[model samples]
Target: MKIGELSRTTGVSIRSLRYYEQQGLITSVRQPNGYREYTLLTIETVETVKLYLNLGLTTEQIASFLTCVLQNKEAFCTEVMPVYRKKLAEIERQIVELNQIKANLIDRIAFLGQQEQGNDE
Candidate 1:
């Protein structure tokens, strides 16, 4: 398929698909007419790239995993798992920080409520 067809099949914009190619997260072959030709496997590859991006992985990180996968190596166990664990830890820390912020907001709200009640009295 051509680039347009691959974009439609993957539901990713043509610009993003081209960016993915530039980032080495995806690949395409150039036709004699200067058109980009994609294999059927490009659809699945694009989907995987989308998934990795949605999971907060950078293009470089996704590229590493994709390279390993293309080489028939154990991407998950060797390349991807460590990065996944690091991301998970970062998310956990963010959750804790957000919880603390929420607690502070709740306390401030309660104190303001008390002050307003005192003023009313």
Candidate 2:
């Protein structure tokens, strides 16, 4: 199919599809007329890319294991384990930081509320 059809089918923008091609996350063939051609399998590849992006993995990271995933060998792909672990660790750290910020905000709000009540007296 053409780039447009791929874009519509994947719900991804044409520019993004082009970028994906550039990033080596997907591939296409160039016609003599300069238009790009994509395989039907590119659809599944694009979807996998989207899934990884949604999971907060970079295209570089996904590029490493995408082929393994496409082959249905993700569990056997040891390289993917470290990537998943690293991302999970990062998210856990962010969650801790956010929780601390939430606690501080709650304390500040309570303090300000008390001050307001004192002023109203």
- Highest-scoring model, TM-score: 2
For residues 1-121, write the lDDT of model 1, one tens digit per residue.
9998998898999999999999987778899999999998888789888888999988888887786765574544488888899899999999999999999999999999999999998
The TM-scores of all predictions, comma-separated, are 0.85, 0.95
Top lDDT model: 2
TM accuracy, model 2:
0.95
**Segments of candidate 2 deviating more than 4 angstroms:** none
lDDT of each: 0.87, 0.95
What would the per-residue lDDT of candidate 2 be over residues 1-121, giving only the tens digit for each residue?
A: 9999999999999999999999999989999999999999999999989999999999999999998889976788888999999999999999999999999999999999999999999
Model 1, position 73: C-alpha lDDT score: 49
Cα distance off (Å), candidate 2, residue 42: 0.1
Question: Residue 13 error for model 1, in Å?
Answer: 1.2
